[model samples]
Target chain A: MPNKNLVGIFDSDEKMLHAAQKAKDLGLSASDAYTPFPIHGIDEILELKPSILPKVCFFGGATGLLTAFTLQYWVHAVYWPMNIGGKSFTAYPAMVPICFELTVLFAGVSTFFAFLFLRGMHPFKTSPFWGLQTENNKFALVFDLESESKAEKVSSLLNQEGALEIREIIE
Target chain B: MTTATASSEILRPPLVEGGKTYGQITDDICAPMEKRPPLGWFVAFTVAGLALLWGVIMVTDLIWTGVGTWGLNKTVSWGFAITDFVFWVGIGHAGTLISAILLLFRQKWRTAINRSAEAMTIFAVMCAGLNPLLHMGRIWRGLYWLFPYYPNTMGPLFVNFRSPLLWDVFAVSTYLTISLLFWYMGLLPDLATAAAHAKGAIRRFIFRTLSLGWSGSARTWRNHEKASLLLAGLATPLVLSVHTVVSMDFACAIVPGWHSTIFPPFFVAGAIFSGFAMVLTLLTLSREFLGFKDYITLKHIDAMAKVTLLTSMIVSMAYLTETLIGWYSANTFERFYFINAATGPYRYCYWTQMLCNVVAPQFFWFKKFRRSPVVAFIISIFINIGMWLERFNIIVIGLHRDFLTSSWTMYHPTYVDWGLLIGLFGLFFTCFLLFSRSLPMIAMSEIKHVLSSEKHGEKQHA
Candidate 1:
């Protein structure tokens, strides 16, 4: 028999969640669960690690702060210092607004790109379940199976858990 | 006890009416984009296009001739253009407020409105950004000077870090970029839905590219949620800072009416007030034209009207405080500025502002008015006009009668000034119409998420 991935399609997120949990309890690892919208707590069942994007955002903001201060200090004070209203070259108060703006800009932009990178999402990339209604109302749970016996067992478990349809794609 | 429980359930209305399923909701929102646009959209687009054309001509003429083509005088150097800029920027705050702050607060009602409101914010910023560039008179030559890029021959001059105008440059640009990112991030899942529903290859290709191959995988959704929350957190403070920096443009000046400490909060309140008004206007019209009454319902209008009412009261208090502080200061120039604002040659403008902004929104206190789309729409228009006049009173009136009596002069906007102002509205509407026709005006994914939770809540209650 050819290697294949089994997909169990369900009508609602709740049914899909229950099936994923049951599959986990049965020691059958799910490759992925796809839904029209996010199912909260599904990650715990899937055993996915929490994303570290917040840390990325913090570091990005730090870099922006350093860049803003260095650029302002170097250009205004060191590069071409001019006496305006007798203010000091450092003018730390004047530096605060740009620093705040740059911090947010960098932090926000980095977090967005990092999330896309971590998720492996970009233009023209295609999902394995392309044209499936998984993006609509349907919820799909995909699993890899090589043996007919394993496929039958997984199919019975999904059918018992209210899967509307069972399909397999050959690798 | 059962009766009480039943009544409480009845009192809590459904956020998404008609008990829409996920598939039905998708069809309702995306169907319009798939079909030919309605007659009203075509008419509105044509009108807006003409207006944008008029504005383009005015801008071209002003650039070719000079800033002198404007009605600006020696005393009133900042005239209609500055007022338009501030008005549009303030109008933008409502969008970010709805999208970022409401999202942070977990106000689900924002799902119906946030997408369009965020679009409005971006467009309003576009409209606001244009005035300054046009006012520069030589935009192509001077535009690069605004940034602090080094390795330039002209002394490698740096922008004035102390200047609030420079702060404004950073703040507004940052606000626009963040707003656009936040908006597009929200659009991704919905774009995927649109792509899935698309029949034609061109439509599918366009949405597929924009959606960046989004699959509703659990891991990605988790990360998307976290990223959106983080963005909303960043945007909340960024939105406030944008208006605060804009306020500093005037507050930093020593001019009597403009130099008040209350300017920042007052300006922020006014910005929201005007913004919600503009939102009401656009939402009401879109509800009628686009047939989205089921989604953008009376409850949404009522919630927005309450916000408008709250901000209006804050704005009125600021006006009173400004007058009080002016009197309490006992300074000749300060006291005269207040008195002149109320009773001088520009008193008509001041009273008109008070009527439209302060008096009109007061009707929202009555449930009859707050819930009525017509009342809300009319008051929104008034607030828009009133907010524009508020900027005019601050900028022109404050400068016209400064310390030097010889420099005092009356200001009148030339035809080009009027053309540009009218033309901007045309541009705003044209962009909005195109957006409504092409994209899902409502957030389909968010609404579906909310609907599922709502169903779960019902199950628990039962």
Candidate 2:
């Protein structure tokens, strides 16, 4: 917990957006923010890339399709064929509904896990500032404390940009 | 910028009333959970609990005594059990439509009601799951057979690939899994907020664990939004496919009333129709009792009424088409079956359905009924009753009189059948009550997005 990071709190997202932009404009590196809800421009303000979740979901759905079809066919047609209702063993039309369901099922499950894994999140731990209500009415900007010189300048910049509260956090 | 835009703006208020802050929204939604239940809540909970207990007893009786406890006979093998299953499944549809479909459509008002509706969908599906489980007299063995495990070890004779019933098993289980994940993903951030705000250590710890250490970081939020959007995209087709498969269980059958090409679309429309009605019914009571008027708003109620009206019309048209096709096809059994649905033993049910579902929702077309929660709530109840009878008439009426006149017989539900059917309401309400207390009843994050514009505008003006 000895590593310190500078944090500034704001009441509204607009102020956070302004402070982040001003800090970035000033050539100060401010990379992290916490908000009660997503501010539309915060991701771009911090210059984060678009998430890769959709592509992951697409692959998940493809895998699901392959798995669903193969299982249905293998069980019904290849393993032990049956002649019920005088229909063919594969019964591909009847299998279509389950296949469609599985495709969705796989995509949803994979995307959820991808979301958690990529975010470096797990249920067993909490954020360093979990007690500060960043996910409620207020917003917080978390910046690196690379050095005392860099940290103090960012702290003063946050104050100048009307940060409601500024605190130093040991991480 | 334009006069038309200005006029429309004047005609409607902003989506959320009171200009509620994120803090205020949390307070409004979460305060009830911390306090003792109101007198009405106590009474409602007690009654629902009793009904649930009664249902449990009846289901136990059904299990111990066998499936014969109800009233399934030689011809009418699927009775109230399947009818109730379909009805409950249909009641779950509006949740997805509001959460997934409306999310895709960018309907912001959905934020106010989607949480409760989705929870309702899960609960309804739970209640729906019961009948099929109980319908299998040997559930211990039957469920074992329904699920796949080491399929190569099990013979093909064990399961039929062509059966619609088999398809239903896959469709419903998948629907439930996706739905639970979707609901939980939306809940994570809110739970984190609740954990941060919570007083007790244990409560905070519990909420924190459930929240999965959500810090609402910009990067995390960006990924969260993408994942949610993708899930919504996946769920939209799934919601439709689940009911379509459910309909195929009947349509794929060779029975006169059951085998119709039109069943898929008709059932989908009907499922959504009944689902919206249930959503309205629960929301009307919850919004009033929970004091979410500013959040839920009159516009949400009115817009929901419009959906109900539209879906009801589609359902009515489907009903008419079925009847018309029966008479037009010159199929004696189909014609007689449709006719007997109106004139035979279950004619009361058929007429009641016509009154409640088709005729009752017509009032929503008028602006006054659409605006009044009392009137709307009452009508929603009627639509619910009507929808149940509609399923009843479809299932029971169709089976009561099979093709051969000599074999035809009237199927009446015993007291046990009535008990279990009525009791499902208890289970649904109980789950909802527990949900209302334990979680943010509205999608707080989404609603905050709607407030962001106003907050930003006011900031600039300052």
Candidate 3:
């Protein structure tokens, strides 16, 4: 038997969410789901884990703050301690702005890169379901078919949920 | 009608008007990019290109002939360059406010204008960055000196981390980087949509590479949403801090008019005031030229006008507070500076700033004016002028007549100064025109999200 995946396409996000929930109840494991925008409650229905990007941002910010403070301290106090206005060599008060700036810079840049890394996104990578119009109006759910008989069951399920179209693609 | 039905009618109207379908939203936005450049775009682009060319010539002359090309003297060492820098940087703040702060506040209306506003931020910062580099005299040497990289020659002398000038280097660059990231991230899903609709392979290849192969998968969307929220959170404070640091450039100094406890908030308010005006100016033109009137509706203009009004009042209050403080201080220099600002040689600039920044936006108090695009656009232009003159008054008036009678020299801007200013506008408009022609000006995916949620809300209410 050839390996195939059943794809269900819906015009609206609401229908897709409903279909996804019903598929879960029916014990059909959906390999992936796609939408034009982030649909509320779809993650819960799919039983996906919460994203770890926030944690990445926090750590990235912490590292940036440390780096800024260390660089400022070393440059002003230790490296070439020049006193112009009789202020202290450390002058941490004056260092606050750059510290704040670097913290945000590090956090923002790192989190963006981390997001792309986690999602396995990079230039020149093409979508497998590029022809489905999922990036525009359509919503899609793909289920890997283990048995030939399962195709009919999946198509019937999608039909009952009012799918706009359904297709089977051999991998 | 029943009470429930009446209340439902009273609810806020739809954000995306014309009852656009998801596909229609994508098509409307992508249409400009897909079609040939309009005649108006070509004419505007040509004018801007010429202006940029003039500016490039001015910069090259300044570099070759030295800072002597400008009107800088012993008294007013920092003239048009610094003022233009602050003005441009201030202009960028509104973009960040719209894209990041409004996003955090969950203002669905922001989906209409945030993409272009964020683009404005990036381009404004680019223009802002040019002034400082030009002011450096020998920019090639001055550029690397701003950074505190290690293992360098000249005794490995590190830049003064305590200096507000150095802090500006850090703040502005970080601001540019973060704004670029936030803007690019917002563009990904829309770029993918554009790529899908793109006819030619080259166009498709360009957008696909730019979009990083966005699949719009639910898992990716989940993470993308989280990252956007986190970035918005980061950017809010970052935006505030950037202008605060810019203010500190003067606040930390001992100049009579520049030194004030109120500089940060004052500058921030004025920045937002000017920025919103610029947004108004651009959006009014864009909606007319690009035919985005439906998406950028009267409601959006009203909201932006209200923000401009609020910031204008804050700026007005700051102006009053500064004058009051100068009077109460009993310091001869401070008192003289305030009085001189109003009635002295540079009084025209001061009065212009007051009329434009303070008095002009007062018209927004009336509903008819707030809703009137013509009124909003005209007032925005006034505010832009007023804000520029505000910087000029602060920087030049503060410097030209300082402590000594011998140092009291009136500064005049040579033609080069004016040329460079015109050139910067040229650079800005040129970039903006190209951006509008090449990219989707509106955020298609966000608009779709708004449409679906509106539908969801209607269902819940029913």
Best-matching candidate per DockQ: 3
Q: Model-by-model lDDT, in order?
A: 0.90, 0.87, 0.90
Off by over 4 Å in 1: A1-3, A146-148, B1-8, B458-462
**Residue range B171-195, candidate 2, lDDT tens digits:** 8888888889899899988888788
Candidate 3, residue B69: how far the Cα is off, in Å: 0.8
Give per-model TM-scores.
0.97, 0.96, 0.97
Task: Evaluate model 3 with DockQ and give the value.
Answer: 0.77
- lDDT ranking, high to low: 3, 1, 2
Which runs in model 3 stand beyond 4 Å of their true positions? A1-3, B1-9, B458-462
lDDT of 1 by residue, B2-101 (tens): 6654664587687889979899999999977989889988889999999999998998899999999999988898999889989999999999999999
Total residue pair clashes for candidate 3: 0
Candidate 2 CAPRI category:
medium
Report the error of model 1 at residue A161, Å. 1.8
Can you write out model 1's per-residue Cα lDDT over A1-171, one digit (the tens) per residue? Answer: 565899999999888888888998998878788888888768888888888988998998899899989988888889889888898889898899999999999999999999899988899798767766888889999888956787888999999999999988654
* Model 2 stretches with alpha carbons more than 4 Å out: A1-3, B1-11, B151-156, B457-462
TM-score of predicted structure 1: 0.97
Q: Cα lDDT for residue B174, model 1?
A: 92
Clashing pairs in 2: none
